[model samples]
Target: MKKFTLSFLLIIVGFINAQAQDFQGMAVYESKTSTSDLKSRFEGNKDITPEMRKMIEDRMKGMFEKTFILNFDKITSTYKEEEKLDAPGQQQSQFGGGVKMMASMMGGGGTFYKNIKDKNYVVDKEFMGKEFLVKDSLPKLNWKMESETRQIGGYNCFKATAVRPVSKSDLRNIKFKNDKKDAAKTESKEKTTSIMEELEMPENITITAWYTPEIPVSQGPENYWGLPGLILEANDGKTTILCSKIVLNPKDKAVIKAPTNGKVISQKEYDETVVKKMEEIRKMNSGRNGNGMPMRMP
Candidate 1:
């Protein structure tokens, strides 16, 4: 009878503990890529006309619809836990007109995760004379976070920010010229120079995340966290990412994995590879004669 009683008590305790745990929420990531902002024109001379630019956009869009695929099976997992305590009068007293008070998450208001992928950007990594094929991985770009605060759902939440900048490196390494886009015009030094200079990072992306200490989890979606309340918004300077619907803790389990389709190289290797590739492409431009063009995109 004692053994049975102990088992029943244990079961009750487990159930209570589970109920006291946080809500398993859905993690969503919103990022903005400047692929739509700028235009690349390739003319017979130093630049491409607007008409040429239009053709290029249409062509690339088709290619993206085909080869540039984004898969979400690579990165998607984080932990958010919130806690609370019952007031004696509210939770225990049968006739008391009181309510259980809640504690913050993170510290009282949030959750945090180590490395979560906001976007499933598969990279074809080639570094240090070795090339990695391609995989769904979180490509590390410029991500910055700041200590700011805001209010949501009547909760005074502390805020954190993250920023990511686009580098002109991709244009240098990857020749988007392909088979259709006149390779001759694409190889022009003046044209390449103009394109590269124009693609410089326009602004730093700022992501504001809120968290509370009630939950003691240092994890969030896409490797974002460290605030005093729930992160309701993550902005990349241009687009604002708001949590439309969130759950505290769910009954089912989550799964997360790193991508293996892209290459893996150290920071140094990436830099060198990009630099070398840029120089090669620049030198290969036969039209501009290495004179370089204006930094602004026409």
Candidate 2:
């Protein structure tokens, strides 16, 4: 066979470069969560007045609304929250200890670094002023492709669904009160307390995601990935993350680097640390405050 001409080879090389450029970009995502359950939980406390409840609700709403940036290049990506303070109400809520834990549980309080090539990830988390670098493999999602499709921000997206097991404590609502029938049938305090214990088995939750193959990077905001394309919208029962804008091959390229400085530990170890710290706080504060007023551990 005759050798290929230089002009033909150049054209093929240019096409390959164009494809590589398509995968290099930065995406901005807006994450929104419904604070109705949180509001209800706060309102249940008799000490809080209606006006105080409303103010807390408003503050929770601000915390729930967040913006994230996903910077990617081929097989590696770094996703982090774009830190911003809009109002004094939100600023005050942001610094609260419980709010930080809640945000971490909701997948909004850390920087996630993932490499699709190696199927590994690192999460940088701060708990009560202590920083932790949690290293673990990526979460494996069993996704089922659906025939449904939609357009988000001008990108044609296909629907995919998956089921994830979530622990009861992970949920914003932890049912403490018993129904009327149960309360009437069992008058023993021990029996009622046992019934209210945290569940051992995880609750199965359905997740729906919309992704577009137009952008071939298998990345999404906050520990969600393993799709055919860039995920445009994802809802995991509790919170929703939607991509608002995408800039491909920007004038200033995004730096896709992982967080390096923190106390290194595995995912399980970090969880244990949090639980141990909480237990210590509870022990320190026991029988100290009265009047049924709310008290937070320092």
- lDDT per model, in order? 0.40, 0.73
Clashes of each: 61, 0
Tens digit of per-residue lDDT, candidate 2, span 1-298? 2356877888999999887855578899998876654455464467877877766666566567888999988788999889866665554653365655656655554679999889888988876676779888887899999999999999999999998765332433233443566644445543223332321323577889999999888988877899989998999766789999999888897778778878998877877776666555554444334332343323
Q: Write candidate 1's Cα lDDT for 198-246 as tens digits.
A: 3333333445566544443444443344443345555544434444344
Off by over 4 Å in 2: 4-22, 43-46, 89-95, 167-202, 279-287, 290-298
Candidate 1 is scored at a TM of 0.43
Task: Please give each candidate's TM-score.
Answer: 0.43, 0.79
Q: Worst ten-residue run, lDDT, model 1?
A: 98-107
What shift in Å separates residue 77 of candidate 1 from its native position after superposition? Answer: 2.8
Best prediction by lDDT: 2
